[model samples]
Target: MTEFALDAPVLVRPYTARRDGDFAVIGDDSRQVYLSIPAEGLDLLEWLRDGATVGEAVRRFEATHAASPDADAFLQALADEGFLAPAGAHDPPPDAEPARARRAGHLEWLSPHAARRLLSRPVLAVCGVVVGVAVAMAVDRPGLVPGPSSLMFHSHFWAYLLVVLGIAVIGVWLHELAHVVGARAAGTSARMTVGNQMYAIVAQTDLSGMWMASKRERFVAVLVGPLVDVIGAALLFITLWLNDVGVLGLPEPVRLVVAGVLFTSFIRLLWQTFLFLRTDFYYLITTALDTRSLMADTGAFLRNLVRRVLRRRLIDQSGVGRGEMRTIRIYAVVWVLGRVVALAVLFTATIPLLWFYLVRVVGFFRGDEMTGQFTWADVLALAMLSFLLDGGGTLMWLRSLRRSSRLRRRAPDRVLVE
Candidate 1:
């Protein structure tokens, strides 16, 4: 802990402090310092705001309240969050208002007013009607949902790759754009970037600024992404059904392209349900429950539990709220189960896929007798898959680690949550 003069007045950096349920939320949005604290913690910030010394604040709090505030711990807590300024400063420090996040500069045109209109109830209702119509059509047609046979685009492989990949890129962009618009509607900033979820590349939005927004607004920010994605995918399905009945009389290649889009879209939606991976739905859960960093806290809880069993120095989680801790404890079980399921699938599917492709490739190089048929195209596909899984995933994971290290250089992940 850094030493502080007990007699000197403490100056707090620019922050917005508000009461939420039984705790106070204090934060500097630009710096991404958000945390929930008990009443005494709020009182301490109030005292410090009025130019109270650490020793003076503690004495005053103990004078009226039954609980005693730890002077050193109090200062350390604030310092941990970068919430403090130089002692006895006449004004808030020059760096109180830091620069905003590295958001998409192109989205400056998307104001809160525009975002609100786009996500308005009327607009949502219209979209809901479109999705409902699509669903009804699907029920009648029943073939709208693409299956395994739909993925066979062998001769039109290049076109399938171009069209499907193009649509996927667009879909991912739109998905992340919804998150940004949602945050903007809440009068907060957001950043969109490419990231990796374990091995697979993913696009994500940094909606940390939503912490300053109200609970209802936070829900909007998180849910908008998945909601828009589902609706857009439904519309694509309807388009394919429209073309199927001689209304459009599209070519087989074109129909195959649409089928490919639908296939991937459905799979993408299913992937979001893997809550252990902290999908958009995970953010929705965290918002609805008003829990701070539930995923991170749950991970820490499991880590400490193992450390405890090993008689090691367990890391402290005392800063987490009691309600949040309860949720974390339950989520810890879900977290473990979810990972087990994911690992089971990886071992079952990924291993077989790897083995099948690898052994055939080695057979070709060795000029050995082939058991099953092999082709250059098959080798090409295998090489691409290997590159994406091995090389691409490794690079992406390293990038994610570097990003986390850069953003969190000043404080621990605990600083953002309760």
Candidate 2:
């Protein structure tokens, strides 16, 4: 049996487990870590904490629980999970110890209930959109006509940004509420958290617990936000149409607010649809593939393949289960094909746009000085620099394409079965 030392004070927290009775190691605010071992494993864990080596711990376990078999294997498994660190390195420095021990408990349950309550019905969601759009129109403009500037001026740019941001926050919260409502309809639970610092907002469904549920349920949950966006867009279009036909006069401020909300809502929907960005679309793709752990496993296998191909030593291969490895192989082939197709399409579409823009900039620069705001030389220089930067980025990404290709060879499958 393999034996490892618990020498480090810091241990890896097990976030996911495949079986019950698995231990969860959590660090405390005071730099002390607690191992929530299974009742059966408690004595062995305690013995190790009491300065016992692996062999001693095993011996103590054998003496205490004679019926327990495979003591050595159990100890090794504990070591692997990082419940025990190597003996000598396990102690934290006295001065630094308290800080290490002070760990905040996971707040997974924090907004689930409120989120559920707020997102329970289709009628309510429809009403929210109607009210949100009505409020936007009422506060901003009477029609599509360009209104007087509504931009607020303040001593601090941050304060102005904050005001605009408040509106954005309301929009985002409504977006999440869409998901919450969808999940509720499908009888699932969801939680929200600050995902990335850029937005300081995120909503996540603990749908991992519902992996075994029907695909229809999963699809409904995934489609909720996009559906909400669609409704919002439709409302905006109707508002615009009404204003154009003179059915109702909208103030300029109200018009601007509605337009802005519509634009942002569409953008949010588009963002979620981009599967490569690992947004809601990514979850949908994964669900379709029926491989719950597709991302983690495929990533591991691809890393291993890259290392092997590049003549580098292989690191952790533990995460890639056999089924995942099979999926990875299939994914790799499909991924390469997809990229080839994408690259071709991007070149065909983007190249012409780039060339047209380049020509415009050149013409703007080279035109007569009297008719032009800027000299030809300045425009030409800026245009050339922009081209060079764009070209450089494209080239860099192209070069990195081979690595991406290798990685994609293990892309998640597009369809999954129940």
Q: Write the per-residue lDDT of candidate 2 for residues 1-418, one digit (tens) a residue.
A: 2336433232322222221223322323132333233444666655656566656766666687685546555555455434444445454332221222233322334354554455557656765777577556645654442222333322333333344445656767666666655555544445444332111124443343333235666776676666666666667756875776689799955655555556556567766754433468777777676555455455556566777898866655443447656776776665556556656755785565568558777556576332434434444544554455445546655655554565444432211111
Q: Which candidate gets the maximum lDDT versus the true structure? A: 1
lDDT of each: 0.74, 0.51
Weakest 10 consecutive residues of candidate 2 by summed lDDT: 409-418
Error of 1 at 242 (Å): 1.5
Looking at candidate 1, the ten consecutive residues that score lowest on lDDT are: 409-418
lDDT of 2: 0.51
Candidate 1 vs. true structure, TM-score: 0.85
Q: What is the C-alpha lDDT profile of model 1 across 1-418, one tens digit per residue?
A: 5566878787778788777777778878756767677767888888888988877888888886867877686667666557885585454344333434444433757889999999999999998999998899899899678986776665645456657878877987888889889888988778888667766677788877777788899888888887877887788888888897767888878788788887777877887887777788887788788786787778678867887798876657877778788898888888899878766765677657667667777767788664434345556565566656644765786687686566545443332232
**lDDT at residue 416 of model 2 (Cα atoms):** 12
